[model samples]
Target chain A: MDATFRAMLEHGYNDLSIADIADEFEMSKSSLYYHYDSKDDLLVSFLSFASDRFEEDVLTAPTGDPMTDLEHVVEKLLPLELDEERRAIQTVMSELRSQAVTNAAFREQFTDIDDLLVAHLRVVVERGIEDGSFREVDSTRVAEHVVATLNGARVARATTNRTGAPAAVRVSLASYLDTVLRGRR
Target chain B: MDATFRAMLEHGYNDLSIADIADEFEMSKSSLYYHYDSKDDLLVSFLSFASDRFEEDVLTAPTGDPMTDLEHVVEKLLPLELDEERRAIQTVMSELRSQAVTNAAFREQFTDIDDLLVAHLRVVVERGIEDGSFREVDSTRVAEHVVATLNGARVARATTNRTGAPAAVRVSLASYLDTVLRGRR
Candidate 1:
């Protein structure tokens, strides 16, 4: 999967080929074809694998604090600062997302990932509300809003890092909790 | 430009050709080449032309209210609601934005459009603040957040409309004005 992702990063979606993925994977095309029938099939599986890793490594990398946990999710998805490898990954993911617009297979993969993130966010927000740590706002709405902001930040960061857009996603989420959804207020 | 944009909508960035655009425009390929050196050059020009049209048609569309003015801008961009034609356009624009990640020309075009929108939003927020209709918040930051949310909403709308993501963008913006940034509070 890493090899496949790396290949996609080097040669974009349009230019990438199964042979390229096979070369990166250090495997024969016939063996690769035995596992996955087509390039789209392999790519879809790759997206699913990436989603699983996101769930394991990032979402589950938690602190006890709900706000902190949510912030971490956003940060993991889009770093306030990115090194070369992470930026390359983001650029490739951006391309995949663009593909998702019209491709039903990609769309389903994205939807699954989006649904997972939003569900986790809803749980955290609801936890805060139940514990009396946060004000009564619609948890679902807040979750949806946060996910959208994260997606927006990804797009913004891809074009220009100077906007502080990624930082603002964290700030806006935190500030919403402090100002609009603070129980103490 | 319309022919180019329409071709993009029909064929997408990956598949679109100069011949395709020229066919749509009912012009000779050489004539089109006389104007635009390559497909990328033509697409970039189309983006610039779209930006100009946005600046003229939507930005200058008037209402007495600043809040209404801002809403109009978002609506023009994402259309809180979308018909098939609008959705198709949004999908093509999404592809262009993805291309912008690696393409400097597209990057500059997107940045220009983003900067223009954000600057207009800042002015509106500042105007509200001066008129004593809003609380003191960093107008620039507010503008950035709004732009991010708008971008996020565009992605969300392209997928599942069930999330109410478009409505959420508007709701978040209005709620910011009414709650956190309310002077009376």
Candidate 2:
């Protein structure tokens, strides 16, 4: 998986080939082929692997406080500062996402990832509502809004290098939480 | 520009070339080359052309009502039902947007388009505030939020074929406008 990530970063999604992945691999080409039939197969597997890691890292260990947990998720997804490696990952992910328009396999993976993110967010919102930190709004709707905003901010930042988008969204979302979600408080 | 759009819909952004565009053109390849040096140049010009059309169609002829105009902008951007041709166009645009992650020229064009959309939205929001149709919120922030949601919805709908995302977002945005932006009303 690391080799695949490195190869994608080096060659990009369009130029990346099985040979490239093999070259980056410590194992033989046959061994690599034994695991995945094609580049797309390998990439699909990589997406699943990455998704699992994201789930484990971001969703599983939620903070006790619902608001803090929500903030943590947002911060992880749309960090104001991205290192070089993170930026490359984002670029690669964006490239792969574009393929979802034409590729069903890629689309399925992305959809699953999005669903996971949204479901996690919904859980957090529900928790907040139960704990009296948030108002009695539609938790699912709130989750969707947060996910959409984060995704939009990430897309804008990645494609246009809009350095201020993430920060601006953070402030806007903070205000939204204060006014709408936290209204009961 | 029509030929470019047609060719893009046919071959998509990655597989599209000058030859493909020329094939779609009524004129000779020589004439096509007379105007643009490369496919990238042609695509950048097409982006500008599309932006102009968008501005004229969606922004120029406002309904003289700020709230209505704002809804028009959102509806045009995140239309719930996409025809076959519109779906193809969205796919092509999504493909091109992926390129913006790496291609500086594409990035610049997209940045300009985003700026235009956001600026237009900001103006409508400011007008709404002046007319007391909307609350005295930060117009720029509201505009940014609206654009981000629309962009995100488009991306989600195109990539995942999450057919309901656009409608859901439309509902969410309406509620947001009611609670936050239309608080004054």
Candidate 3:
């Protein structure tokens, strides 16, 4: 699964053939097929896998302070690494997004990630309101704002940085948190 | 040029072929060569052309209230089918950003657009302070935040809308402007 996921990251799952994967892993197509049903299956599996991990991290992870936890979540979720792992995840995201345009299955598979993130943000906003960390704004809408800004920054960082410096991602998240949580009074 | 730009948007510039563009346009390779020195020329021209028009409209053409000018500029930049040409221009912006990463030249071109937008935003923040439209903050960085939100909202609307409704973009922009500029003092 790691090999398959990494392959998808470097070259999109849509762009790669089973032969390509086999060549990378030094295995035959029959062997590869034995493990996975099809290309889409592999992608769906990857999405499910990542989504589970992300949900656990965002929702279940123990972090104190709503603002700190929110900032930490964005920092972790950002694909800010030059290694194959980060690239593979980014390629998967980009691929899933393109396929989601016309295909319902792909859209359904990836929608969970968006939902989980939004739900997590909403919790943070609610807590912020209680703790007086945020003003009286619509929590859901603010959550959407949070998701939009982070997603935008993620996509921007992916394109802008070739070596994938964590600094850019960190600065962006800090600024985002500062602005969104601005004027709590 | 249209074919190259379209190809870039659909499949990314690196993924598309000059032959695909040449055949689609029904033009000889020689003629294509005459018009453009290289594929770089084709892609750069598209970015340059779009950015040039965007600069003139958003930056050069001014309503004179730097604070309100930006709000108006965001309006002029993001419009509904209430008009045609404006919609087309915004469509171009939302579409190209997806492919901007694949081409280095195009990426650099986009950075210029981002920089110019940020620079103009800084001017707005500074005037906003004087005009009492905004409280004091890091004007330069705050400007980057504004552009990031606007650009992010544009992409989010492109991806999330089922019927391609333009209303989502407008409401989000209004909300963001309200958040950023509210005196709250």
Best by DockQ: 2
Ranking of all predicted structures according to TM-score, beginning with the best and ending with the worst: 2, 1, 3
Candidate 1 on B1-185: residue-level lDDT in tens? 87898899888899998888998896566789798877999999988997897689767854667777777887787665578877777788888888888898998898888888888888887887887776788888778777887788788766533456678667765665566556322
Which model scores highest in TM-score?
A: 2
By summed lDDT, the worst window of 10 consecutive residues in model 3 chain A runs over A160-169
Write model 2 residue lDDT over A47-136, tens digit each, in one string: 888889889987776777888898898888888889987788888888888888888999998898888988998998898889888778
The number of clashing residue pairs in model 2 is: 0
The stretch of ten residues in a row with the least summed lDDT in candidate 3 chain B is B160-169
TM-scores for chain B, listed for all candidates: 0.89, 0.95, 0.71
Interface RMSD of 2: 1.1
- Residue A143, candidate 2: Cα error in Å is 1.0
Candidate 1 structure quality by residue, lDDT tens digits, A1-185: 87789889878898888878887886566778799876778888989998898789777855777777877887787777789878887888787877888788988888888888888988888888888777788887778777877788788888753456678666766676566557322
For candidate 2 chain A, the 10 contiguous residues with the lowest summed lDDT are A176-185
Give the residue spans of candidate 1 off by over 4 A.
Answer: A161-163, A183-185, B159-163, B183-185
Candidate 3 wrong stretches, greater than 4 Å: A12-15, A25-28, A34-41, A78-88, A91-110, A130-135, A161-185, B3-16, B23-29, B35-41, B76-96, B130-133, B161-182
For residues A1-185, write the lDDT of model 3, one tens digit per residue.
56666676566544676555665675466777897777776667767787897787656664658887777777666644546666656656765654554445666655667767777877887888888877665666666655666666665654443232234435644754565566532
